[model samples]
Target: MGGSGSGNRWRYGIKGTVDASKRLDIRYLKQHGMLRSGYYSLSWNRGGEPTGNINVRMVSGESMTVIGKWRRDASEEWQPMEKTVYLAHTACAYGGSRSWFVCPYCSRRVAVMIIDAGYVACRHCLKLTYASCNEDMIDRSWSKRDKYKAKMGGDKGLYLKPKGMHQRTWQRLRHQYYEAEMQGWQWAAERFPMIKDWM
Candidate 1:
């Protein structure tokens, strides 16, 4: 089951794809006024459970130092890791400015940075792909359908719109949900002929 055959077809390499969901967004920090000369803690959670966290000290428009403990893999012991990530600002079209993190390895400006191999870097430098990239059409469609369903305030079915949502918006979302649902069913039926009967 662990061989490099069919079982591991979707498995990524040793330093698996960096999780985009768990990232440091310079935009978020700037918007929340966290880009100041102070200390902050960044954390991540999975299903209401704490997974990991890091401490960041901001130097306001210059750079931010990240302090955390990380390990390459489960076999190795966790080690203290500290690195300073520089910041870059670009002018926006309308007005004001936007912030980005300068990738430590490539020196590219990126809005989000992920921790990989005990260091923080942009996704490109890490050569990582998103988990959704390995998903098939059926999976993508199901995800979209579920997202719209949840927006309408239920997971079982799309019957009524959630309160405070406009009629036109609800109609649009319902149509989108139905389309995604049908697409998911179509793909599933193609994979398993028996599923066509239920459809």
Candidate 2:
């Protein structure tokens, strides 16, 4: 799962979704169609909440569309949601058309929307959180360092250098990585003593 021969950068390219409403570009769909398709179980990242799985589907039609189902609960009944492409033909001096999804509620053009309760609107409408929303800056920083190390084939220990990277680039990244780690350790010690063993 590193970006080595058998590895790919799939996960890093995923843009965090704001809500259930995400857009699939018309031209892109016509060619690749659901560029990043997968079967995933999502927890809503909430404590004690029900876990659900979403099934994403795509097919050819008047244009192109992606139909999805979000199970309301663990029981298996799925709520239907769709992101279909729409082509708007326009006659301008330049002569062009636009392709976009309009929020069924707001009529504003949007690329993607998360399927929330009744809103079925954009991330702004649904109030989704980024992956880091639940973490402090220190924790995020430490995580960044860990990822950097992993990329360099270093594990658990610091001071390992990567192959093929220039000295200047490596030094810059190494400095930031350690600085972040120290900040995280200091913060952890003061606030949560039990974390010492874990860290």
Ten-residue region with minimum lDDT total, candidate 2:
1-10
lDDT of 2 by residue, 91-132 (tens): 447666434455555556655545543235555555555555
Candidates' lDDT values, in order?
0.80, 0.51
TM-score of each prediction: 0.74, 0.53
Which 10 consecutive residues of model 1 have the lowest summed lDDT? Answer: 1-10
The true-versus-predicted C-alpha distance at residue 66 of model 1, in Å, is 1.2
Candidate 1 lDDT over residue span 1-199, tens digit each: 2221222224455334556446888878878889989999989998899878999999988899999998768899999989899999889999988878999899999988987668788888777777766566678888899898888888534676677889988888899999999988887787678998887
**Number of the top candidate by lDDT?**
1
The alpha-carbon deviation from the true structure for residue 52 of candidate 1, after best TM-score superposition, in angstroms, is: 1.9
Error of 2 at 15 (Å): 17
Q: What is the model-wide C-alpha lDDT for candidate 2?
A: 0.51
Off by over 4 Å in 2: 1-31, 34-71, 74-98, 117-119, 156-158, 193-199
Model 1 TM-score, all chains together: 0.74
